[model samples]
Target: MGISRKKIYEEIADLIMQDIKDGVLNPGDQLPSITRMAEHYQVSSASIREALNTLSVMDVIEVKHGQGSYIKERMPLGFEHEFQIITRKDIENLLDLRKIIEVGCVELACSHADEEDLGRMQDALGKMRTAVMNNELGEQADYEFHMAIAQSTGNQMLVDLLGDVSEKMLETMKETRRIWLYEEKKSIQKIFDEHQAIYRAIAEKDSGNATGAMMRHLEEVATVLLKQHK
Candidate 1:
């Protein structure tokens, strides 16, 4: 079942609270930039804004003008533990499902994508490059570029399926990114290269290359999470 929009906002709020309770975030600590939070939460800026606002209304955080949102000295009531929603097995399942859908979608996109689709993907890649330059994880741009490939497939069912599971996928993506970027100490250029390969293959209308690229990306994701699970 698809998650409701309101529930997504609440979930984002809970993720932040979990970080706080774990002592990963401290009072007076400025939260990650809104863009970073939106990527990590797999929500839009508006949704993140609403989530932040919800925290503010509950007096859990303070949003100061001319500055970003800050953790407040006082936490809302009953935030003693993390609100975990899924297990490692669940994340592995999602990556497997994504591989099945996305690999096929890329094959279709190779034949169906037009110049406009290519342009959208190019723009997303540009954003990714900029994110890397700024020492950001570029998760949102990475999602959008893959989404552009799905969009190019011109199959509403494929598109709908991806959208339905995207929320769950976003959560796993955060974990995967954290491992590769921070825990594993991997170079960010590897991520950029993988994405660039996918884009170039699609741009060249090469289904074989696109399928292989998609598989490589998804396989790495699944492998990382599975390793973490073990």
Candidate 2:
């Protein structure tokens, strides 16, 4: 049997949820209009509107009358009302998925990266170094460096996915850093070294090494998060 409209709505809801959880739809970001979303998902506008309304009721989004639907920024609470819900496991799974995708991206980037890509990466690295030395604005530089790598892949879909993953990781890292009472120096240096390793691998067009380096870096970060949570 063909999938029912209810099932289609659920599928759309799930995709939106994944995007939200990954931070692609940031707080206050307006979603596409119902008609646009409906067209994209090959569903009725009414179904899209219903899904948005459901999300709004769950506090995952807000729909303003005569305005549009916007993502909400509330932190997920455990065992709360249906409004806000997320678990530690969910965060871990997201991080794992990010690592998998990033490994592939690094491989592709190494194969396709150009001089302009290298230049942009160098700029990001320079900013990161300055931020580390000056003890200011490190987070932004760190994000830029990773984003540069994602851009090097020359794949819009991968770039977009990384953007979403990076945003979530940034928020989670901020919280993890606070909880661990960690200083930025050692972490920054470690990340700088890993970035250098990845850059060198890409420059040499060593896809295997590029993917390995990226995975190692992600594993290190994951280890830190797990330890902090423990």
lDDT of 1: 0.77
| Candidate 1 local Cα displacement, residue 74, angstroms | 16
| Top candidate by lDDT | 1
lDDT of 2: 0.69
What candidate 2 gets wrong by more than 4 Å, as runs, is 1-87, 175-187
What is the C-alpha RMSD, rounded to one decimal, of candidate 1? Answer: 12.5
TM-score computed on alpha carbons, candidate 2: 0.57
**For residue 51, what is the lDDT in candidate 2?**
75
* Model 2 weakest lDDT span, ten residues long: 176-185
lDDT against the true structure, each candidate: 0.77, 0.69
* lDDT (tens digit, per residue) of candidate 2 on 1-230: 12355456666766787786676766678999998898788788877886776565445678888998887766433112334333467568867887877788788888888999989888888986885575343556667777788888888887888777676666554443332223232455566777889889988999989889988877766765655444
Instruction: Report the lDDT of model 2 for residue 90.
Output: 56
Best by TM-score: 1
List the lowest-lDDT window of 10 residues for candidate 1: 75-84
